[model samples]
Target: MSKPRKPKGRPISGWLILDKPLDFGSTEAVSKIKWLFKAQKAGHAGTLDPLASGMLPIALGDATKTVPYVMDGRKIYEFTVAWGEERSTDDLEGVVIRSSTERPTEEAIRALLPKYTGVISQVPPQFSAIKIDGERAYDLAREGETLEIPAREVEVFRLSLIGCTPHLAHFEIECGKGTYVRSLARDMGRDLGCFGHIASLRRTFVAPFGEEDMVSLADLVALERVGDEGERLAALDDYLIETGEALSGLPHIAISDDQAQRLKMGNPIILRGRDAPLATPEAYATARGKLVAIGEVAEGEFRPKRVFANH
Candidate 1:
């Protein structure tokens, strides 16, 4: 009398695009995924504000180690900004602290959009998690000390005025990582002479993942109640572009089994065919595919800065 063994849960790897719900922080989504999959390791590609909602990429197990690649991907956001107002938190989360000097027209907003496109320097809102020293900037803001944060360079590949209302304007933005939509709205208000803040925000895409892969909180709750986490997880695969595919834009060079073995043992992969400069040494490795390790180009070899998991 022998009993057959059943597989635990699906050995989920790669990325997960959760349509993060309002009121749930990025960490909460990760927690839910951890409990649902019983994943030993998991992490989000980027953190989302509780007030905002949309595509939040969650990495499961070995996928968690691939977070760095995901984090650097370009982000797309569709957000509504309310004109003639301002908030301390930069969005609806804060109290109204100021009013606009004039009611902005659609033409005015449209005219200003071009200025924000391409590479630009913008300061992140005080109510942000950017760390200065060991403490968060938001923590300092809450403590009532004047925030003296500095401006940073961010690339706004595209900023389009999608729709407009008398008081509300919706914009679609494709920007580099570290770009804050809330700050963009705030700065727009400043440019328009009518201060404004983000009234609503929804991330439409995180580089490769789009609305098609998004999963709402209602769906997650229903799946949890039915004890049917597997089916729900299947719906998420379309959103996860896999870490390797995500980094496909970078140059690649395959290696022999012996070379891979050596690379895995912390040796350089001895890169070839790249006649150009490189970024960080750790930035080249992809989670899937032939990308086994990330390294730097030196005199003649790409020294292993970091190695992907063997399996």
Candidate 2:
């Protein structure tokens, strides 16, 4: 029999809400953080395009288990749409495929808002990460292949126009998961008869995280210059938010130390007391304010679906 190889690096766990800079890919940010923290595992909750900037919540070690909860949360984006030409990629990065001299008045744009707000079907941009027949849509697009991407329902909780000039318009949107801001710009341009593309886009919020929680890339880089190795690692560790913070949107239950131990061993704990929840589809269990497991509450017991290691 062969012994299992232990994973390399420290088993650090928590979330890092990054203020992703423009032109930095989400995967690149995760890699950089993982290397800096020397963590054994890491992942990001959402995908932010290289062209976009702002809040990107990254999970390290045990925090990766809570990524789905964060990804399903609402997001807010502020973007600028430049009227005149529509690009093949639906952003400044792509070449112009259609052009129009026409510009929609502010009144016309405001009137169009109602049509896009709430539940509406949106087709993702051609140069997108969406998979098609086991291949990426963007890969096919780079090869000069045009595909008829299907439209899927996305909800825009709120969509408002901030300001506009003859050639440009600024807007802010709060939307549900799977909403595509690029598609919104393209469809709006086509509707107003003033072909347009995303000039700039910034995500100010993603679910439980907001602008206030974001740490700039420059700030993280500066920590590397700390004189002592121990101090430097400590400085970086200070920036990590608790793993349980990502599950703030979900129902939470506090358990005893004994119960926490039982959960760690993958055993269900019986719910006692009248205050205990009878049932919940999804909930998180914590002991002494530290996350222990994410589980389902049913049949008067808390059944763990995913367990987390102690920090």
Candidate 3:
């Protein structure tokens, strides 16, 4: 018997703030959502480990262009650190390399928060996706190769001790790009002399989105399973946020349809006359409230860098 052909997804667009469940990798979640929506193109704003869960912003079609903005935005996470074991991977998934009976007092843990907040150097865990010599650091570590991953600066906006016990400490942290929670746990452990590792992690939100914006995969799957193709697509649309919403962080300039056409055609629009607002370094140009393009505004000219396909 011949194998059946795989169904090709439709030309769908916009974003899905998926409430990724624990144990589902970011890539797998993106694939599932893409299939559910039958999208033509898909990508995610950030990578979330299988061990972590919560708001994973998946971008479909033109929405992918705005992924960089969301990725660069701050992230908030609530995680638990089991304070007696140190692991090779810096999380529960790895082998325990050391055990400790030491546990810091609540006051002690809180005192260390200031030390980690703001710009601080962090050495990523050996078992991580970071590339070294074109090979994944985790792959190298699994092969028993020792790696000296250099410490780099990362920003932690806020770090708070939420709750704690003799063996477990819970924390909520808001951080900027390149900040690794696993590394934070490892260093916090060393600083406390308790040798802890991440036990559980849940990303509450990524900037431009929050927990309120998230929809669980099971909810989308339930909608898809119960209806015909037409109805399924309609139901899915209820959750698909508009692509323009992702660019909300940037200042928007409403241009004339003619200006939008010129911008789309890769021609600079002269921002002269009374209607033109003062130029910003960069801005999103919209025509009748629809995103036309993203561009640099210099000396009264809108120079298109990334143009969006008008729907």
Candidate 4:
């Protein structure tokens, strides 16, 4: 008789925040990480332009399942605006095609930033990842085709001016998902009666992950070098944050061994053990106090909307 096939090893599952380096697209960064971790399933939560860098969350293994839940969390960035130049990509990496004639004082620029805070409509740059008629807008831009990228409704929760000079301004941003900091810098220049693009950008936070948690390109390259020289890379477990760490900020309930087994059967559970039944579906912690899934109260029954973990 033929020998039975052995099951493949389970993938390492958890969220990892990388300090993205300049010139690397979000997809490229995720690809490198996928190679490094050898995780069968992996994904990134948001897109970052190659010209920008900072807090980028990469979901490895089954952790990719939780990406949607974490995506809506707040984000923070520190970006710079150059006073008199504009480019095709809305950042310095793109060829400069326009220059502004007007110059505004630092204080003048600071006063104008508030008008952009809160809910607003923004037209994305022509050279962007936004899709149009089943084709990438940037691809069309490269084809020398003109596209009227529509204004999108995005929110900027906070915009704080950190420093300023005659030709450049530094600022911090705490904004909702899809708030394009590069686009914001471009528009800010226009608001100042000048044209501008992002010269430097760094992301500091994505809800549960922060700057302190980010692994840098230099660090990853160092690991690669060590492995190339026949040294071991990090331990298999070092990269993992326990599944619960992903939802540490949210409220939770503890399930006993028996209840955990029952949850796997897809049966509805009573709210008697939970902190409170969610009025609307939202991610909630598990009976073991781990973030398990999104739960909702419907017809006096609690049902799981998304289950992020099985262990």
Candidate 5:
């Protein structure tokens, strides 16, 4: 029988809330971070387009397990829509497909905000990452194939017009998961009969993380100047947020060392005491401030679903 292969690099774990710069791909950013930290595993919670910038939460090592929690959270974006033309990709990168001389007034734009807010149906842009018949929509778009993409429901918690000019308008939106800002621009343009496309877009927040938590790529690159490899790695490690911080929205329970051990060994622990929760759909267990496992409380027992390594 063959032995298992040993993983390479250090097993560092935590979240790195990156302030992604414009024109940089999310996957490329993850690769750069992993290499800089010399970590064994890395992944990002959400996909930010190369055209967009700001708050990209990245998980390193064991923290990758909490990515779903972050992705499901709400997000906020600030964008500019330039009137007079619509593009193939619905953004500045694409070629102009339609043009119009008319422009929507500031008052008209503000009046349209209510129609977009709350639960609404939205059609995704053609040059998007959405799958169509087992192939990426963007790939088909690049091949010059026009697709009849279906509309899906997306919740927009709030939508407001910030400022506007004869040729441009600025807006901010807070929305639920799967909301597409590009489609909003396109739909508004088509509705107002002015034709428009996204001139600029920046995501300022992804739920559970905000601007204050973001670290720039340039700042991370500067840490590489430390001469000693160990000191350099330590400097980078200082920026990582605790893995449990990602699960702040979930119910949490503190357990004893014995309980932690049993959870690590894949055993369920009985819930005791008057204050113990009788049942919960999902909850996380911690010991001395370290995450042990994420599980459910049912029938007076805490069942381990996903266990974490000792940090």
Candidate 6:
């Protein structure tokens, strides 16, 4: 039998800030966008639950190397909690296990908001992606196994009550990595004595990239359907943000071609007389405005940590 040919896409480098749609898995979204761009390699900064929607940073080619930095960036999420109901998944997607008629007053919720702020411990939802004995926690929960999800410390920069009603309340949260909006909602409901679950969730942004940079799949598909192949590709390129944008908060350093060449070969360059931006010991080095490497500076020497293959 003839060997089945492998499908290979072109090597495109950049970041695509996708405004993810509800009910679409992160993996599926990445696959669709990857196909549209015909990118050889692709990845996402973090996984957004299929039930949640908002900014999902899709990294293409060399941009994938910066996913770790993006994942560590602060995140903003605006969500709604429907009071008086508890669900197995802690979101609307699962079966409801309990309900109550009690609802927290606007004053009561506002008062409780302060308690959720700062560093706090939260137990991630059982129907989550956390691994348990080499298997996913959700897989175990789906198979009727009860799992004890430990409470871990997560930083909540700000938690504010944005709006409220008799049955539901809206909130906006700024949190560090690993915080779960569902857990916050569930805990809030419990504190109010009615029990609650996340009825709706939308991430406003994931640092560096904001709502202003987001593009929808429908819009991307429309661009792909227009004009000739080259024109379509050009249209797509217009939406792709440079990979260096992911390193926005990091320090920037301009290095000479010789330094860049040495960095590419995983060598450290001494910056004795060179003026390096010392905002942070860690910085992104560029040569002629193109990202060359991410490195650290110590004792006037720039050390290549991760070199980009964009050139």
Candidates in order have lDDT scores of: 0.77, 0.94, 0.89, 0.76, 0.93, 0.90
**What ranges in model 6 sit over 4 Å off?**
1-7, 272-274, 277-281
Q: List the candidates' TM-scores in order.
A: 0.81, 0.98, 0.94, 0.88, 0.97, 0.94
Please give, for residues 88-200, the per-residue lDDT of candidate 1 as tens digits: 98899888888855878999999998889988888888899998788899999899866878899999999989889888998889999999899999999989999899988
Q: Which lDDT tens digits does candidate 2 get at residues 97-120?
A: 999999999999999999999999
TM-score of 1: 0.81
Candidate 5 deviant stretches above 4 angstroms:
none
List ranges where model 3 is wrong by over 4 Å: 1-8, 272-277
Worst 10 residues of 5 by lDDT: 271-280
**Of the candidates shown, which would achieve the greatest TM-score relative to the real structure?**
2
Candidate 3: tens digits of C-alpha lDDT, residues 88-184: 9999899999888888999999999999999999999999888999999999999999999989999999998889988889999999988899999
98, model 2: CA deviation in Å? 0.5
TM-score, structure 4 vs. true: 0.88
Better of 1 and 2 by lDDT: 2
lDDT of 2 at 42: 96
Q: Between candidates 3 and 4, name the one with more favorable TM-score.
A: 3
Error of 1 at 165 (Å): 1.5
Evaluate model 5: give its TM-score. 0.97
For model 2, the superposed segments whose C-alpha errors exceed 4 Å read none
* lDDT by residue for model 6 (20-57), tens: 99999999999999989989989999889998999999
Worst 10 residues of 4 by lDDT: 228-237
